[model samples]
Target: MYTTKIGLAPAIHDSFIASEPLGHLLQSSKWQEIKDNWNSEIIGFFDDDQLVASVSILIRPLPLGFTMLYLPRGIAMDYENTALLDYIFEALKKYGKSQKAIFIKFDPAIQNLPENEKVIQKLKNLGAKWMGLTAEMHDTIQPRFNAVVYKADFDEEKFNKKTRQALRKARNSHTIVKFGRDELLDDFSEMIQKTEHRKGISLRNRDYFEKLVDTYQADANITMVYLDLKALLIEAQTMFDQAQKAFETKETTNEKKIKQLENACSKAKKDLSVLTDLVQANGDIVAVSSALTVNFGTHTEHLYAGTDTDYQKYYTAYLAWFESIQYMFDRGAETVNMGGLENSLLETDGLLKFKKNFNPKIEEYVGEFDIPVSRLLYPIVNKLYMMRKTRI
Candidate 1:
């Protein structure tokens, strides 16, 4: 009643994935182009002549000629269809055996909802080992928790007060957001490098970033936020002048108003001084923040982003991120994924705190699963993989 097809063409594979509700950019065939280090294949399951399911698998060579098969956020199919699920696993096992794959690992993009308990159990029933619900960032290959902003009429007024204030400050400071492809890559890369050094974590290099833009083509964008120091300086000076005049002309015996005027004058003076110094050191304009995003199907993902710490007060990152989201939506993307977050969802986490400003709904996935092909080698290979992962 069912048949399997290997090496499905990119367009055909992408079409099937785009048609599914759980479709993700990771499952797109173009992602294989980004993960060039891994040998990849697109496998499709069909009922007669109609394609029912598909997964883009990445194969990595392991020790002693064994291989590991990974389907990142994959198996773009209806999980409720029991028969299709069984047949697909069986087909994958047979294919894995042919390639001496130790096991096939996958972490579907399905959210961990109450109704999905049956799907998890069904995976176990098929002899796939469920990696427990991990709450840490490094506990799994892909993050188990993601922050997402679902599509609606875009409204800035709906944002929290702090976020709105930040956006206002960014605008008042004369920050400009520009979106492009390869042209902005250099600025984007520099910001990411600064972030890497500040956070003490390694991220993708320039070459990898280049590959992403090149492979994804029109769907990918690099957004850069630039600050016009000259304009900011003028604005700060104007504010300082107004505040100074207000303080001097205050006929009111209200000490509170006098104090407010004094504070405003002092803050404006400080900002003006800082902007002058920055202009002297950098230039009239400087790139303060940058982000990379990719749109696929109905969703857009904010992949990697960074900000120059020196210009932190300018809040350019906020403008960059918000503009990128707007840009993606303008291009017809329905959902914008803010990417991964730590599972704990603690307010103390700086990344979570920053992403929460946008008020995203946190999605917890069903974690990873391993379908062992060579039961004898799976345990050993998995152990080694885990150790290597931790070191990285």
Candidate 2:
């Protein structure tokens, strides 16, 4: 019989997940550190004393001494193997019931492949419910559709037009910090708050930001992307001065050098004009936008980002994303998970449109499923949950 263990050492979980293909950050123990707000457990399933599957399950306390077991982008395992999934879920249900959990909610990262349909049908036959793909935001705990950047043959000649533009602009301009200073976090949080306010979405607290970076520490897994606008302004001025001096030089011939000088002067002037405008608005140096990425396994996840409301015209967000893509790609990452977009190709949300710059493939997960400990309480709790969630 297969066996399961709870609250195992992180090394055990790490080793198991690392051996698998592209373990999600949510399934990683690193996420356990960041999600300190919830009670968590590292679970492992074994066959003949050899580890077969592992997951990080978060427990949320509910009313009347009951609990809800939630796995965010988790139950990370081989979805194709029905035997493994059947064994693991049975163990999980038994353990969840023992822990007074009313239900166990799972949203695996499995896409809706043709072969995957067989697995879904098998799960249904085994009494597992399926939430059919829906574009509604509240239909699932996480977005059903996500933008995934796959590792293709790196062709320098054929880049997405927007990717090319963002890269060129970033390369020619200011600094892109991988891990910015602590002081920059406050600015980043403020920017996020302002953006969230404008968009009418709920905003996270500042401590959430601090804990995420601090939990990841200075590891390559957590990449913080930000721009030093002051540095760009100063560099632009220097380039302008150097270009002007070179143009006035006597040694310069009226050939290709003259054309080069003219082009340099023109670019420097335009950059100066843009930089000067930004500097005048924000002061000596300021962070216009910032993004935090979590690198785990073979993929880098672009988790959260925000732009200064005033500096949107400068396209700092696009630049930040471009540099982040390059950073992960350079380090041999297999994919860049650009995060979620609502289902539906016709959706014109700005978030989806912005992430579309990278020409990402839309990965659709088959929403969430719930395994209830008590069938009688399931509908009651779900109705209450829907009511409360809708109010949000």
Q: Count the backbone clashes (under 3 Å) in each candidate.
A: 0, 0
Candidate 1: 10-residue stretch with minimal lDDT: 149-158
lDDT of candidate 1 vs native? 0.89
**Model 2 per-residue lDDT tens digits across residues 212-304:** 777766533333344577887888899899988888784856688789888889989998998899778877667666777666767778777
Q: Model 2 TM-score? A: 0.82
Indicate which candidate wins on lDDT. Answer: 1
Q: After the best TM-score superposition of candidate 1, give how far the Cα of residue 82 lies from its true spot, in angstroms.
A: 1.5
**Cα-based TM-score, every candidate:** 0.93, 0.82
Off by over 4 Å in 2: 153-156, 173-178, 181-183, 220-281
Candidate No. with top TM-score: 1
> Which tens-of-lDDT digit does each residue in 1-392 have in candidate 1?
89998988889989988878989899999999998899999998899999999999999988788898999998778988999999999999999998899999999998899999999999999999999898578889899998898768356888989999999998887888898988888888999999999999999889999999999999999999999888888887898889888888889888898888889889888988888898899899889999899988989989999999898887888898888888898898988999898888888999988888776789899899999999998898889878888787
Error of 2 at 311 (Å): 2.8
In model 2, state the lDDT of residue 355: 77
